[model samples]
Each structure stands twice: as C-alpha cells, then as structure tokens.
Target: MTATDNSTVRDADALRADMVRALHDQDAITSEPVAAAFAVVPRHRFAPEAPLDLAYDLHSTVPVKKDENGLNLSVMSAAHLQAVMLEQADIKPGMKVLEIGSGGYNAALIQELVGNDGVVTTVDIDRDVVDRARRCLDDAGYGQVKTVLADAEAGVPDDAPYDRIIVTAAAWDIPPSWIKELTGNGRLVVPLTVRGTTRSIAFDRDGEGLISRSYRLARFVPMQGEGAAKERKALLRDGVVVQTDDERVPLNTKALNQALDTPRREFWSGAAYDLPDELELYLTLHLSSAARLHASKEIVDSGFVETSALLGVPALVSEDSIAYRTRRENEDTGGFESGVVAHGPQAEALADEYLKLLRRWAENHRCRGAATIRFLPGPAPSTLPENSVLKRHGIVAVSWH
Candidate 1:
C-alpha cells in the first residue's frame, strides 16, 4: 500500500480503539462481544461523506439522508447509544435478528455479534436509506447482512420469528406483527416515545403482551410512514409550543397563550429533585391533563419560561391554564429542589396538583428504573389503567413502585 493509504488505515484504527474505550468507560459497552464489535467495525465507511472524527465520536450521530425541509430522515446513530442498545439486546451467536431501521453500521455491528451462523436483516421505510445502507454494507464488507426497502411499521415478516428485533427509530407503539414475528423468548429493544419523551425500552414477551426489562432516556428521529406519531402541536408563539397525544388534554391555543400573558405563579414542592428521567416518567403519567411544554432559548432567556421548557417538560394543562416543573439549587436538598411554575386563573389548583406529584415521586420513587412499563397490545380497555397512555395499537401502562 502507498504511504497515504497506510496513514488513513492507521488513523481509522486509532479512532476505533478510542471509541471503544470511551464507550466502555461510560458503561455503554458492558460485554466483551459488544466491545469487540465496536473495535472491529469501520464506522466511518458507512458514512463516507462525514469526516472520520465525526464517525468515531462517541455521542454524535452521522447524518445520512435529509428530507425536503432539511430534517434528518436517516442517520447513523451515535456510538454510545448503539453500544447501550446492543447491551440491552444481549444478542447471542446464531440468533436471528431483524433490525426495524436501516443504518449500515448498526446492522454490521449486529452481524459481528451474531457471528457467521446468524441472520441479520435491516428494513427502512425510505428507499434511499435502504439503497445507501446496502451500498455501505457492501463497501464495508458486510454484504451478508440483508437490506429491505419497506416501512418497518409492520416489520419484515420474510424473516419471521427473529430472536431479537432492534428498532433504530423512535416508535409510537408496539404493533401486533412485531410480537407475532418474534420467537417466544425473543427480546425487542425499541426507542418508544411515551407522552412526548422517548425511552429505549428492552421488552420481553409476557404472554400476549410485552413487559420492560429496563429503559434508558433516548432521542431519535421520529418514525415516518404508517407508524408515525399522532401527537398534536400548537405553536403558542414564535418560541413556545405545547404538544400532546392524549385526547383529553384540551389544546385551547388562544386561552393557553393568554395564560402566558397573565402573571406567573411559582410553587415549591420542598422535595429533592434528581433523576430527571425517572421524575419525568412519573409526572407525564400521573398528570391528569398531561402535555409537553417546550420553549426556545430566546423565550427562556427573555424570562417568559423556565430553562426546563427548553428541552420539553411534563406539563399539566387545562382549557385556560398550565403548570410545569422547574428546579433550583438547594444545599439542604443535596443538590436541587423541585418546584412548579403556573399560569392563568387555575394556576393555584394546577400548581397544587403538580407539586403533589413531584413530592410523591421524590419521596417514593427518587431512584432510577423504579417504574415498570407494560405494552398491552389490543383494544383500549373500557376503563384505562391508572398511569396509562393510550395508543392506536395498544395502551402503555406504567407503574411506579
């Protein structure tokens, strides 16, 4: 090989080693098989358009395809997240795996985990993504992995009864086909969006339904096509918005905007605030009229909304009022204390309800992984279970213990 070719190879190898070490240090790579896979995969080959540094970045995603509006339609998911999900899947050699989203690198990594005896098929809704993934896989010497061009909402039944089904995109619900196509003891690791937040939940078949083994906070491009999210969004102003999928949550945009004009009310919960993911799950599920409150940095900087809204926070909404969580540093509480910010005539009542839930969570479920999530795949029950969110395919029931 020429000197320039040798240098490029060395650089890629060095970056791969660094990436594996960082993933291991962060506890994302817990098993030897996963670490080895990360060590060997030439991640940069999958996203040839991206720089080598970006391809190896532990926490950054490499964009592959974009839509007409410049929104990402497909991306090579971040390495740390890939490692975390792989650990969650716990793939064994000779297992048949079907990945719901097409990204060549992740599917290649799965091929490494499953070894030569296993089958790896990746499906995507976008034809461009499937074509790109196929080219990248062939270029990266992973041509053994099958690529399918179709919406993964129904999953790839051509290879049924997969031992593991890993979804790379954010899913709104667990469709019936996914469960039926899985082996009796199969595992489905999906980034499931509940309320407005997404969690990478590792679920195992429990009778006809599925139950979570663990869940981690996750962010991903929303799934497109048949399984797209049905959430409604109201742009209250240039920098603020409210979104919800719950039919009962009143989306009175005019009244909600008027509430923002009224004086804001603050209520302190006197409860220690930490473990944001766990706290958020509790708030979103328990709030009667739950919605997500989001604000741009400009609005937050102008003092119209708390920084919490910058990344979307659980909100209790009424026809003409809203209350959401905020935080402040408190030495007595060990770090921060949770509080509620309210607006409109029912601010006091909304704040009271929000504060009660916050305190209850802090007192009873302050730690991580305290909630158990179950996906009951069937018609909605006449009386929905407490702390449950309804979906087109089924109901997501979550309980904190």
Candidate 2:
C-alpha cells in the first residue's frame, strides 16, 4: 500500500483506540465482548465519506441520508449510544441476531459479538439505506451480515427466532411480529417512544407480553412504514408547539395560544428535583391528559415560557389551559425544587393536578430504573392497569416499583 494509505490506516487505528477508551470511561462499554467489538470494527469504513474524526466521535452521529426538507432519514448512530444499546442486548457468541434498522456499523458490531457461528440480519424500509448498508458492510469485511429491504414492522421472519433483536430507529410500538420473532428467552433492545418521549428499553419476553429490564434516555429518527408513529402536533405559534401521540389528548392550538396570553400561575411542589429523566417518565405516565410542550430558543429568550419547555417537558392540558414542569433553586429541597407553571381559565386545576404528580414522582420513583414497563400484546383488557398507554397493537403499561 502507498504511504498515504498507510498514514490513513494508522490514524484510524489510533482513533479507534481512543474511542474504545472513551466508551469505557463514559460507561457505555461495560462488557469485554462489547469493548472488543468496538476495537475490531472499522467504524470509519462504514462511513467512508465522513471525516475520520466524526466517524470516531464518541457522541456524534454521521448523517447518511436526508429527506427533501433536510430532515435526517438515517444516520450512523453515535458510538456511545450504540455501545449502550449493545450492552443492553448482551449478545453472546453463536447467538442469532437481527437489527431492525440497517446501519452497517451497528450490524457489524453485532456480527462480531455473534461471531462466525452466528448470523446477523439488518432490515430497513428505505431501499437506499439498505443498499448503502450492504455496500458498507461488504467494504468493512462483514459480508456475512445480510441486508434486506423491507419495513421493520414485520421483522425478518425467515431467520425464525433471533436471540437478540436490536432496533436502531425510534419505534412507536412493539409490533406483534417483533415479539413473535424473538427466542423464548430473547431480548429486544429498542428505542420506544411513548407520550412524545423516547427511551431505549431493553425488554425480555414474559409470556405473551414483554417486560423491561432497563431503560435509558434515547433520541432517534422516527420509525417509518406501517409501524411509524402517528404523531399529533399543533403549532401554537411561530415558536411554540404541542406534540402528542395519544389521541385522547386534545390539542386545541387556538385556545392554548389564547391561554398563553393570560397571566401565568406558579405552583410549587416543595419536592426535591433530581433525576429529570426518571421524573419525566413518571409524570408523562401518571398525567391524565399528557402532552409535550415545546418552545424555540427565540421564544424562550423572549420570556414567554420557562426553560423546561425548551426541551419539550411533559404537559397537562385542558380545552383552554396548559400546565408544565418547572424548577427553582431551593436550598431546603437540596439544590432544586420541582414546580408547575400554568396558564388560562383552568390554570389552577391543571397546575394542581400536575403538582400532585411532580411531588409523587419526587417522593417515590425518583431513582433510575424505578419503572417497570410491560408491553402486553393484543386488545386491551376490560380493566386496564394504572399508568397504561393504549397503542394500536397492544397496551404499554408502566408501574413504579
């Protein structure tokens, strides 16, 4: 090989080593097998067009394809996120694995974990993504990894049962096909979005339903095809918006905007504010009429809504009112105290209901992995459990334990 090629090879090796160490330090790589896979795989080879630094960046994603509106269709997920999900899967050598979203790099990592005796299949709805993944996998010396063009809703059943099914996209629901395709003791690691919030949950089969082993904060491009999320969004104004997946929640944009014009009311919970992600899950699940409130930085800077709305905080809404989470510096509450901000005619009621949840979450489920999520397939039971969110295929219920 030429000296230029030799230099590029050396650079990649050094970068890969750095990435492995960083993943370990970041606690993304916990297992020796996962570390070995990260070390051996040529991550840059999967994103050849990308700069070496970007390909090796611990927390940055390399864009692959984009829609006409400049929105991402697919991206090579961040190394840190991938490592975290893989560790959740905990695949063993000679195990059958299937990756729902086709990204050559992740599939290649799965291939390394499964080894030569195992098989890896990656399926994607976009033909371009599938073809690109196929080419990249071949170039990265993972030719055995199969790439297929199809919607992920109906999994690659030809492979029968996969010991581990890892979904890279943000799935709205756990389709029956996915559970049917998993082995008896199989685990599926998916970025499951509910109530407009996404979490990468590692679930294992329990009877006909699936139960969560652990969940971590995650963000990904929404899944496409039949399993695509039925997103409900209302633009309150140029810079403010409300989004929800639950059809039960009303998004009266005009009334809500009018309510914003009313004076804002503040309600303090007098509870400690820690572990925001966990608190978000509890609030979203327990809130009777839950939606997500979002505000652009420009609008936030204009002093319209609190900073919590900037990150799309859980909101409780009525026909003419809205209330969302907020925080304050409180030495008594041990640094920060959770609170609620409300607007419109029913502000007091909305704020009261929301405040109750904020205090409940802070008092009880304030720690990590405090929720047990169960995906029960088929039609909902006549008597649904508390904190259950209805889905097309099944019911996703969460309980704080």
Candidate 3:
C-alpha cells in the first residue's frame, strides 16, 4: 500500500470508533456483528479521493463527483445511514450477498461481516471504479469478494438466489431481475427514487409480493450501462425533465404542476417541526400500505418559518433525506431542528392532503428519532433505476399491518 493508503487505514480505525458512538446516539444500530464489521473495514481505502477528515465524519455524505452544471453524480452515504441499512438487512455469515457499486471500502466491510462462510458479489457499470475496487480489495486481502465490471441494472443472475442484495447506487425502481434472483424471504435494500424524490428502501419478499419495512431519504449516482441510458435523449420544459407516465388521477393536477412565485408569510406553521392533526390521522390509517414513500428537501427563507437563535436548523429537510450543506456544519446541526424554514411535498397544500399522513407516522411508530418510509417494488422489472409510482408521481400509501 502507498503512504496515502496506509494513512487512510489508520484513519478508518479511529473513524470506526466514532461511527459506533454516532450510531448509538441515533439509536440506529444494535447489532454487534455489524458494528464490528464496519469498524474493521477501511472506508478511506475504497474512496481514495475523499478528504482525511471526512473519512470519520459520522454524518457526512462524501461527494464522489460533480458536473459543470453542479449536479452530483455519486456520494458515500453517511455511516449512520449505512449502519441502519445493514441492521435492517440482518446480513449473516454463510449467506450470499449481491451488492451494487463496487466501492472497495464498503465491500471490505461486507467481506469482514460475512466472514469466510459468506460470499459477496459486487457489480459496477464504471470499468474504472470496478478496477479500482478490485485493487483495493485485493490489496486489503479481501480478494475473496468477487468484483464484476458490468451494468448493475442487469443484476448478476449467474449468482442468483442471493440471501441479500444491496444497491449502493440510488435506483429509480427495483429491477425485476433482482426480485427474481432473491431467495424466498430474501432482503433487497435499494436507494429508490419516486416522483423526483429519492429514498433508500429495504424490503423482504413475502410469497408473491414484497413488504417494505424501512426506508430513508438518500441520494446516489444514477445507474449506467445496459439497464441505463447515456444521455437525456429527451426535451426539457423550462429546464425540467418531463415524465411520460400515464396520468389517471386529476386531483390538484394543475396545482401540483403550478409553480409558486410569491413566498407565503407563515412563522412556524407547525408544518416543519410538528405534523398537523390531519396528517397524523392519515398516517395512522395508511402507514402500512404506504407505497413509493420517498422524501425530498427544500431550503426556504427563515423569515417564513420560525427558528431558534443563530443556531437555526441549517438544513431544513425532513428525516428521510440527506443534508444539502457543507459537511462541517451538517454534523453540528444534526439536520432539522425546532426552528428553521423547511419545505417539502408534505408541506405543500396541493400534496398536504396525503402528506399529513407522514406526521401520524411519527406519532404511532417509534422512528428511533427518525421516521420510517417504505418504497414498494414496481411492476416493470426492466426499469431498475426508474421511479415506480402507484398512483400519482409521488409515493403512494400502502398497508403494512
């Protein structure tokens, strides 16, 4: 290993301890095996370009790349977020796990967790990333984890019947091949996007259907290769990409599409920090059946929403999202707070009728300080990374219990 690689390994050891503490603080991880696995796996090794300080920032989202237009391509998810996924997955030794995105550092953690009994097969569309991961894993003596240079959308069918499947990259929908390849009761944890919002959804197969038990707002690089397209290959309306999905519902269609020009003057409408009574009731009835449950973030002026002192909620999104801010401040803010100007689909009057359900979810279920959202697998198996909506463009409510 080079000098930089050696330093990263050392930093990971320290970062692992901090990560454990952060997990405990959030009440996100409870498994000892999983925690130990994360501790041993060197994250910096996989992401060579990331800064040293970021290697251990518990709540940081490591940026992978950005285009000239300022669009982010990929990110290394926060430690707590990944920990939640691993805990939900209940990954065990002797089980075969199919992982998307060949990040050497993350794969190393999986390899350590699976031990010799378990096998990890990672696929990535970028040949360069795949090759880099291969070298990192091999150098770290984790060559046992098989690395494949292929489009993740295709799903590694040759290694079918996997006990667990995890996609590091965010997908629009769960590819049908992945569902087909899963063993009965198998788990599939994918970062899903629905109606322009992205979330990490974890589901388990139950007979003919799949049930989502957990979800989180997450962002990652879009998938590429056989199951993905190279360019937009479409027209844009006012710089926004348009969808061609069949529209059946007409409720507030115009209002949903209409853009607001003037800002509303409402101070802490109880919409940002607290859920309204109406929304609380909705979530109670449909929390279980909620489908395509994804979350998005919006930053508004503090004048509209009341905030605490100078230490306002720097990032004003809900629980199911990654912070859109600098890493240094995100750790201190810990995301949303009591006082801050926040905006979301749930907060909009056009969507508020159904979004209020999210509030009830917080009251009924103990979110471990965060809310639980679910995304169901879509009808089309071919569209692995496309949003799968049940009703409108947004997440639809589904029944769980």
Residue lDDT tens for model 2, 57-79: 99899999999999998999999
Tell how far residue 336 is off in model 1, in angstroms.
Answer: 1.0
Ranking by lDDT: 1, 2, 3
Q: Specify the poorest-scoring 10-residue window by lDDT in model 2.
A: 360-369
lDDT-best of 1 and 2: 1
Alpha-carbon lDDT, every model: 0.93, 0.92, 0.55
- What TM-score, over all chains together, does every model reach? 0.98, 0.98, 0.66
Instruction: Quantify how close model 2 is to the true structure by its C-alpha RMSD in Å.
Output: 1.1
Candidate 1: which stretches are off by over 4 Å? none
Q: After superposition, how far is residue 264 of candidate 1 from its true place, in Å?
A: 1.6
Error of 1 at 315 (Å): 0.7
TM-score, cand. 1:
0.98
Candidate 2 global CA lDDT score: 0.92
Candidate 3: residue 275 lDDT (0-100): 28
Error of 3 at 203 (Å): 0.9
